[model samples]
Target: MTEPTFFETPQPVDLATIAEWAGAELVRGDGAAEITGVAPVEAARPGMLVFFDNMIYADRLAATEAAACLVTKKHQAKVPDHVAVLVCKDAYKSWAQVLSKLYPAAVVPADPGPNTISERALVDPAARLERDVRVEAGAVIGAGVEIGSGTVVRANAVIGPGCRIGRHCVVGPNVTVQHALIGDRVYLHPGVCIGQDGFGYAMGPQGHLKVPQIGRVVIQDDVEIGANTTVDRGANRDTVIGEGTKIDNQVQIGHNVEIGRHCVIVSQVGLSGSCKLEDFVAIGGQSGVRGHVTIGMGAQIAAVSVVNDDVPVGGRYGGTPAKPVKQWFREVTALRKLAERTPST
Candidate 1:
């Protein structure tokens, strides 16, 4: 894979301006100086600045060689007289401002390739097609299916009639979608089956009949779904995803599942129908979630957990039959301690 190129160099900024921008007070140790770069405390040099978020590294303040440092208000006194300190309520916030000022990365647009599309392929005339937007021989596109400037739809990547794709969004080769809304900066890996048939079946007196999947999948911006991750269309309502939710390869998301923003679902994680996960939920690799379960915000499920019940907010859970993270830790610790204490005669 080709590494992306940097767009521009850092613009020089002073500590006073940084302090004003971050709503922090600048407590100077020396004259006002320009910060050209930022790095870890141990790695900072004469022209670069650094940040200290905790007290574990307070002892290293005497040895820091940077021009200045950003520290929390509580830790400001720990800085030695040799270095200047920028005190803020949150050191991380100040660090982010400084980093953004110093190291803004470049944005690269997708390059559309010269793949061929059939003349009869129904592409919306208003859709934006870039250099490498390839429509295959017989695919039909609805109006308002905005193919980002550089996306390629393989011979059969049937984009449902009215989808909006951001720049560089990839509708991989042979994928199918209908009435779906996709955000910008999204990537649909190859063989990804989105807006597909759900495993919905109706039981009659004689046999089981299939229920039609009539809903759509709404994917937010900056999401990267792995290859072959099949997100089933809803049964009656939309299956929605928040921004930056990453679904790993081969994951199965059942109908009407709502995944919150920035959640990471690892490979082979199976979410049954109508599950709701709040923001920042991290489902470990191969975990299975029962249908209609609501996982609270910021919960972490360890790998291979079989979650049959709802998880509380801001907790970590782990087990074959998932339990709270602290309990799981205790169980593992007790077993390990017992093994260590056993006689070795």
Candidate 2:
């Protein structure tokens, strides 16, 4: 995949001004030194701002050629004399602030331009598209589909019949939406497949009977589903993704799964059928939740965990057949000690 080019080039900002924006103190070197971009310590150039927070990258910090560095007071001593320093309580957070100031998000145009909504696009006459909607080339809008104002349906996207896409939503390239009610400002990244039939089947001696998926997918406002993610439709009840939920790339959300508000599901995570994730639940990358389990509000599941039981509210779980993090750590330590004591084969 080609990297997206930034339309707006960043103009150089002086170290002192950037420090003010990040709420950091300009502690050393010339405050007037210019910084044009933000990068990791090892990759930073003379006109860039870099950050050093962890001691694991101390070597990179010592050798960075950045014009300015965002550092904590504890690590300030490690910064080179020629590199200007902005001292802050949290170097990572301050560095993010600096980057945001330097490179603001580009605004996508709502109106159909020369590159959008080509004559080759197929839009059924029965489809209702509101004003300022941009349907790109090769996009197929089925009959009875309603797309609200300011929504952009990118190239080759397919919106099935009767689907309702709300205002200001972005249906990215190659996305397929069917039997879905999507809310305002939702972002469906490239290759997203919504409202597909779930993995529901009845076992029998003769053959496995496929259960009919009749329910829709209800995606609430401000939800952002990343590239290639799949949200399956419910078998009977509606599968709902609550407001402000962000699902990362390649994540799989099963049928009848109800995820509450502000949940963060990282990349490659899988939530099995009929699972319930309460508000503020965070599942790390590659985690798998068993079917019919309930993860309570504010629970945190570590990366690669296999959760087979209900998790209590505010719990931190890890490991296979996931348990509380503290117990998991103890078990791991005990196993390591036992291995060390055992005689070599």
Please give each candidate's TM-score: 0.65, 0.90
Worst 10 residues of 1 by lDDT: 104-113
**lDDT measured at residue 274 in model 2 versus the true structure, 0 to 100:** 95
**lDDT agreement of model 1 with the native:** 0.80
**lDDT by residue (tens digit), candidate 1, 244-266:** 99888999999999999999999
TM-score of 1: 0.65
How high is the lDDT of residue 243 in model 1?
A: 96
How would you encode candidate 2's per-residue C-alpha lDDT over 183-242 as one tens digit per residue?
A: 999999999999999999899999999999999999999999999999999889989999
TM-score of 2: 0.90
Clashing pairs in 1: 112-131, 112-132, 113-132, 130-149, 142-161, 166-184
Pairs in clash, predicted candidate 2:
none
- Whole-model Cα lDDT of every candidate shown, in order: 0.80, 0.91
